[model samples]
Target: MTWEVRFSGFGGQGIVRCALITGKALSMYDNKFATMTQSFGPEARGGACASQLVISESRVLYPYVTLPGVLVALSQDSYNTYEPKLRDGGVLIYEEDLVQPKEDTGRVQMYAAPVTRMAEEIGNRIFANLVTLGCFAAITKIVSAEAMKNALPGLVPDRFLAVNEKAFDRGYEYGLELLETRPLSIEEAP
Candidate 1:
């Protein structure tokens, strides 16, 4: 089985880091094969950034995603750019506070999390990406909690590892709450 995941947001949001961590979780910890590719806009910070990961139980034959099975849109521009390319029955995870998503014409199952807000509550907004990663793990159940946690220590700065873990946990908790309620639309998301 293969899962194509695309993580998109503006620069400085750790878009590429999210994919790298997830790929590590899937490949090194979860016994899966993951290949990642990244894209950055012309400008450095505050510009469009995207990272795609192809995951499978076996070797990955393709490095790029044809139609992402999971689209994590953290910015409005990313949502607008990639939402239409999501495959039927795809999973859409977005920042509830940032992205105002359009109606999905296909069989896409959309989920929203207030990752940035949650990260701010944790402390700073920089941890928002980790929070989003937590939500991704909870909603998708593709990466194990143990795997996600294990992938953290080395990837993030030593001083901020604790905060990153906290952000991940917060997001994970919120995601579980969302799952329990199963909010139907972006309007229904909390």
Candidate 2:
């Protein structure tokens, strides 16, 4: 089976970095294979940014995520842009504080988590992407916690290592909480 995930937000939201870190962790530590690609705006903060991930247990030929199994949108613009492309029965996880999705897209399961608020509470609002990553990890178990721990040092710069680690851990735990409350089904996206 294969999993296609898309992460999108404004340029400085770390959407690309989150995709890369997840792909690398799955490839390096979890022993699962993955590929990642990204697109970003010219300006840093306000422009659109998107990253896609294709993951499988075996060798993956294609590198693009045409129909995402999971769509993580951290901003309203991103949500509005990618919502229609999500596969039926796919998952749409968004930041509750930043985005308000349409009434109900029955084809996709919707999850609204306050990742930005959680990150700010942790004293680093920039770690919202990491929080979202943790939520993804918990819901899917696509990458192991140990793998995430190992991937952190390489994914983040040395100066902000501690903060990044904390952010990752916070996300991981929050994801677990989400899982315990509402487990994600493994059914294929239609």
Candidate 3:
């Protein structure tokens, strides 16, 4: 199976890091084939940035995502820029507070989590990406949470690992709650 995923947001949101961590977890820990690419604006922060991941059971021939099957959008600008490019029947995971989604097209499945707000509750907003990653894992079942945690070392500083792990757990649990309550399996978009 192959999955095309995109993680996008303004800079300083760890958009690129999200893809990196997921790719590494799948490829290195979960024994899948994953290729990743990144694009970002010139500025260090508050500029558009994105990372694309192509995950498969076999080798990946291409590096970019043409039509994403899974989109993780953390900002309104990113949701606006990438939502239209999502494939039919695709899955969209977004931050509810940060994005006001357009009317549903009835072709894609959408789920939202307040990752940034949750991160703030944990002490820093920097962990929002990790939280989102956890939500993505739980909702998509693309990779295991154990694999994600195994891939975190060296990527996340030792001092912040505990908080990051907590953030991930919070998001993962929230995603599970969403699935139980909202049912992402529904064919029609909500």
Candidate 4:
């Protein structure tokens, strides 16, 4: 299987870190081939930022996500920019707190999760990225929840280790719930 995932948002939203964690999880725990890349504007906050991933069963030859199979939009600006790039039938996961789906787009499957709310509920706003990652894991099954959990300590700072782990677990479970109700098919690209 091959997957190209794009995570985009404002600079301070942790798009880059999220991408890194994903790559690390794939490489270290899942034992899959993965590559990650990113682009960002000048400002640290409110600037456009995007992180891309390419994962495969064999050695990944490219590090860029040309036509993403999964797109994660963490802000309205991100939705506006990358939503058009998703391949037909691709999966899009967006932050419900910041974006309202464009009802007219029928080419892709979209899921909205309140990542910020989930993070806040877990008592740490910084874990929003982890929550979103969990959502991705749950929906895609690209990385197992066990692998993600095992990979966390290396990705997060020592001070935030515990809560971030909880946040990831919550997101993963939330994703799994969605999957149980609406499972995705694994057909080849048309």
Candidate 5:
């Protein structure tokens, strides 16, 4: 099966890097194939940004996402912009501190976390992206935590590796706890 995922947020939030890391984890460490594409808005820093990744067990023919099955929205603007395009029965993940979903998510499944708040507990808010990635890994189980951790060394600066790993762990642990403590309303993975 193929999974199309979109990571969306304002610029300077490492939105594009999320796709890059996930693609690397799936393709290099998890033995899956992945293709990634990214977009940035015209505004300098706070503009909308998004990155798409297509992951499959086999080779990926297309480089762009046609119908995203997973949507990670780290900002209100991004959630509003991409939520409508999510495929039916898709999974939607968002930053609870930054985004708020509508009363209904249609047939889509929804999960939320305070990614930025979690990052602040570490060193800075910059690592929220990594935290979100970890949450995604646990919530989706598309890639193992070890694989995602393995793909991190080169992507993050050597000095900040430890902190980034901690951020990831925090999110992963939180997600695992969520799964274990709460019941999922959705039936299947999209």
Candidate 6:
């Protein structure tokens, strides 16, 4: 079965890095097949950016996402652009401070976390993506925590690993807490 996920935000927010880390974690450490595709505008910082990931137990023939089963939106623009593309009963994870989702369609499950503010508390806003990744992992349960941790060393700088690790832990814990309150998880794959 294939699971399509999209991570989206303005550029410089590490939208691409979120997909990269998730793809690496799932493919390299978790023994899953994952393919990623990305798109961005010309501006480096404010441009809209999106990364699509396909994860499966077997080989994935198509690399692009037509309708995402899970959508992680870190900005309002991303939410506006990708919300309509989400399949019915899809999961939506968003930054609480940045996104105000549409009226409840009664068809999708949603979770919001203050990842950027949490990252700022940890150190910098740059780690927001990792924080969001942690939320994604804990909420989705598609990729294991060990796999995600194992995939981080080579991805982040040696000096910043500790901070990033902290950011991940914080976000993960937040996700777990959210799950306890919301009690929502991805529906079993058909």
Clashes of each: 0, 0, 0, 0, 0, 0
* Top candidate, metric TM-score: 6
Worst 10 residues of 4 by lDDT: 181-190
- Candidate 5, residue 160: Cα displacement in angstroms equals 0.5
Across 23-115, the per-residue lDDT of candidate 4 in tens digits comes to 888888888998998999778788999999899889988767888889999999899999999888888999999987799465887788899
What's the CA RMSD of model 2 in angstroms?
A: 1.6
- At residue 115, candidate 6 shows an lDDT of 93
**Runs in model 2 lying further than 4 Å from the true structure:** none
In candidate 5, the residue pairs with backbone N, CA or C atoms under 3 Å apart (3 or more residues apart, or in different chains) clash, namely none
Q: Clash number for model 4? A: 0
Superposing all C-alpha atoms, what RMSD in Å does each candidate have to the true structure? Answer: 4.4, 1.6, 2.7, 1.5, 1.8, 1.2
For TM-score, candidate 1 versus 3, the one ahead is 3
lDDT tens digits, residues 1-190, model 2?
8989999999888899998888888999888989998888678677999999999989989888988889999999999999999988888889999998899847787777899999899887888888888887777777787787678786788888788777778877887777677667778643
Ranking by lDDT: 6, 3, 1, 5, 4, 2
lDDT of 1 by residue, 86-171 (tens): 87777899999999987756478888898999999999999999999999988888789889989997899999999999999998
Model 3: residues with Cα > 4 Å off, grouped in runs: 186-190
| Residue pairs in candidate 4 whose N, alpha carbon or C atoms collide under 3 angstroms | none
Instruction: Give RMSD (Å) of candidate 3 vs. truth.
Output: 2.7
Give Cα-based local distance difference scores for all models. Answer: 0.89, 0.85, 0.90, 0.86, 0.89, 0.91
* Model 4: CA > 4 A from native: none
The total number of steric clashes, by the backbone 3 Å criterion, in model 1 comes to 0
Clashing pairs in 1: none
Select the stronger candidate by lDDT from 1 and 2: 1
